[model samples]
Target: MLDIAKTAQLTPDLLRSFLVAADTGSFTRTASLVHKTQAAVSMQMKKLEEDLQCLLFKRDGRGVSLTAEGEILYRYSAKILELHDEALTAVSGPKLHGKVRLGAPDDYAMKHLPGILREFSVNHPQVQVDVFCDDTPNLSKMLDNGQLDLVIATDNVKTKFSAPLELTWILPERMDPSGLKELPLALFHPVCCYRENGLKALEKASRKYRIAYGSPSLAGLLAAVQGGLAIAVVTKDTTAKGCRHALPSDGLPPIKSVYIDLRFKPRNRSEVVSVLGGFIAKGLGIVI
Candidate 1:
């Protein structure tokens, strides 16, 4: 047990290190996140473990995992850090100022990002926000070209570092199925993951299909869908209010889960970007 006196002395910095370690499961990655050497992160954990009077990590040559006690600490650490950040923002005033270029897909920008950006703006009123909408591959290219500061990229299942969302097929609610011989598609360009998966599923099912509509803009896809143009595959979040989806019995194949990667140069020195990243992770209920 971590003694009450020792627990009271735990610093936000130490807890942050532990969190980075737990999220990434790598001391090197955690070190990069905290702007310290791998050795410094290790030292902080060692000091933290001593204070807690328990083994928090299962150390091996490869990496670390939370012990039973560490898992408990990790949960409490998240809440503590969240509250601490909120308090700090309240006390520090709206001092952070700068423009941040944030990129995401049209669907996410519409369905999810508004709340995230809105909350961030309420807390940091001095910062300016610039939003860019595009698919993941193009967004990745833009990020690589230094055209964007940060991006929420919908990566394929092969993406290494993040948890993926499950994909599904979407269509108008109560769409009639018995009359159709050929499936129609209203989707993004060939570079889009949902488009590719949706097409492949139809092909594997031996169903005939035609592209009724194609657009780079997600709004176009949704509009075409609303007008009874065609069916499309998208994340559950992106599905419209009156739309329904294809189930396994409908003959659509299962889509591979997609990872949403937060793209940025870790070494970049910008407090606003760092702060925005924290807000994004917190908003999405995911640790980056």
Candidate 2:
């Protein structure tokens, strides 16, 4: 006879935390991603390990990495969560049926939007998510003009829904910026946060730099950077394969942190719009 009382059951919360930890390879980062304290995340992982009666993580100086058992669990955890969400939607209520006009910068649309949209579609299969890619200033204008139901913008002072984003200096793998007296840069237009912040940082640091290439498109700027025409300041997520970060030893000025802001019209906002907005914010771990 089996002792059912002694068996440990896996819960969605624990699996979610574990999945984040595995993906990030850091409990601290996982804590931030899941909106929990580091200690709380640690406790959850400990409980999960105890429940499974197996070691799932190997801790080292850099961070934690998954063990063999952890790898196995990660695969199943993702499927389980997917099915979990699917099951809830199937029984919860009538599926939401509407259209959500979403706008984002091209960079974010490529780097971050896909997974979030995929999850959203799973929950609300009938809802149509229309994505428009443009610069932040243009996206904000569209949102204000009621051309878009929701938008993700680079944060400014008045932003209410925001999340932290890290910026990095991206340079071609074979090129070094330190050797040049006047640093060459591939930058966006004046309205862009990357352009404004990067130039400001270089000026404040008394570094001489010139706009070697300028474009309104992320693809064009990345091409310039990848071709070693110039370095660029961009969000950490969008660094290309042939590029590397400008390290402290590279003698480049540090870029400041920025925020991803979510915007929506306050008046006459439909329930579906609000739902999509909340979903995006939550997906990005933005605090309302």
Candidate 3:
């Protein structure tokens, strides 16, 4: 039998490495992230498995995936690290302090910013983050003009980090497309990709459409959709209660997937901005 107390002692170092490996699904990437060699990382994981007396990872063609035991460990590891960081911060004081200007589309802000900003505020209460919500083009302009430190953009060409977003057509649940003479659109500004893609798709399909409502705010668009005023384009993960997804069979043409991209101002690449950018990337599951 194994010595329970001795074998079960999990050091923060091992747990941190394990978390990084699990999150990234590659020892090579994890090594780069944690500043260790690939061989050292492999040895650490082997030791971790030996200590735990269970298989934590399974090899695949691409990289590695967590076994059931590893999944459990991953969950626990995140909480463990969170608590560890909280304890250290409580004692050592907030190490990072400065202001960061962040910009994102209103929809992205509604979907992703809350949890990320909440955790960031907890960790660096001294850091003041001024957030601006705008369309991707405007945000890009702001970043290039040195008016913003970091920006999250949708369907952007240039990116420091990025994640895929599946596009979809959203409309009132009970509204029938065939009954209407022309499809009405609720969209953002003319420069927005969602509006552009949606319009291009409609035109290619030879479908008649009119801009029924226009709004920069996600809420306004959703309200227009829910109120049955117009159909709107949104990401698949949008969960407006009264809205149903429109299919290609419903005479709506398909919109190609786009990326949620992170961008940084070259001149404003301060430590605080970097920290915030890293936090946003981690939150969005994008590796920097």
Candidate 4:
């Protein structure tokens, strides 16, 4: 048991080497990052696999790549390192004291993110937040341009990381099913994930539909829905009051909400990125 604990303690350093190696695709680069020799890094990785009883990396003429176990370990190691940094930040106050420009879809900003932003602000009062509410593509562009430090947008453009949400179609309470065939759809602008899914499902099912209304803002969309203009697809948590779900009748596909973050280079890279990433994970209910 004592030996097991000792081995477990070494696992993090092993993971560190593995992550660096995978990123650089070279044990030499990993060795430089860890201040160790290439042989030392290789030995640590070998001991890691021995301790876990699993192969974590595959090496060949094409260069080294992560095995299945290595991919899993890398994902968890990133999270572990994130939490470890968060702990250090909590103990070492004011590490991230600067303006943080964040972007989110209007719906998330209006409905799902207030409590999260409030909590984040309370925890780090020294950090000032400026928020932009926009469509996913616009936010992605802003993130790419470094105009935004962090963004919370529906997954449309591919990014290195994303968090998932469960999406559902919502309608006015006690709405009649007889009008299902001629259902009016509420939608955002083109390129929105929810709108795309909703339209695809309708088309796939051959359900006759028309756009009764559209809005880039959640408040406008909900207001339109409340007034019996149309039904809309949105995340389960983001649904407003006075609305009920409109489940697919037969062959329509279900939709999933994926929240993707753009990787931005930060001025205070470690501290700012750490807090922003942690806040995002906690907001999305991802277990750190």
Per-candidate TM-scores read: 0.64, 0.70, 0.67, 0.61
Return the lDDT, model 3, position 285.
63
lDDT of 4: 0.70
Of 1 and 3, the candidate ahead on TM-score is 3
How would you encode candidate 3's per-residue C-alpha lDDT over 52-116 as one tens digit per residue?
Answer: 89999998643678999999999998898778878878898998999999999988786677657
Candidate scoring better on TM-score of 3 and 4: 3
Question: Clashing residue pairs in candidate 4, if any?
Answer: none
Error of 1 at 124 (Å): 1.3
Relative to the true structure, how large is the alpha-carbon lDDT of every model?
0.75, 0.82, 0.82, 0.70
- The digit string of per-residue lDDT tens for model 1 on 1-288 reads 535674645688788788878866678656645567889999899988877788999975446889999999999998997787778777887788998998888876765565467558657978998999988888888988888888877766544335567778777766654357887888888988777777777788777889999998777887877777688877754545456677655665677666676778776638999888777766544566
| Candidate 2 global CA lDDT score | 0.82
lDDT (10s digit) by residue, model 2, range 1-288? 544347767788888889878876777666655668889999999988877788999986547899999999999999998898778877885568999899998877765675477557766878988999988889988988889999888853546688788888999888877888998899998899888889989999999988989898888899998797899988865646567878888999888878888888789479888887777888777877
Q: How far is candidate 3 from the true structure (C-alpha RMSD, Å)?
A: 9.4
User: After TM-score superposition, what is the CA distance of residue 55 in candidate 2 from its true location, in Å?
Assistant: 22
Please give the TM-score that candidate 3 achieves against the real structure: 0.67
lDDT of 1: 0.75
Put the candidates in TM-score order, highest first: 2, 3, 1, 4
Summed over model 3, clashes come to 0
The segments of candidate 2 whose C-alpha lies over 4 angstroms from its true place after superposition are: 1-94, 156-158
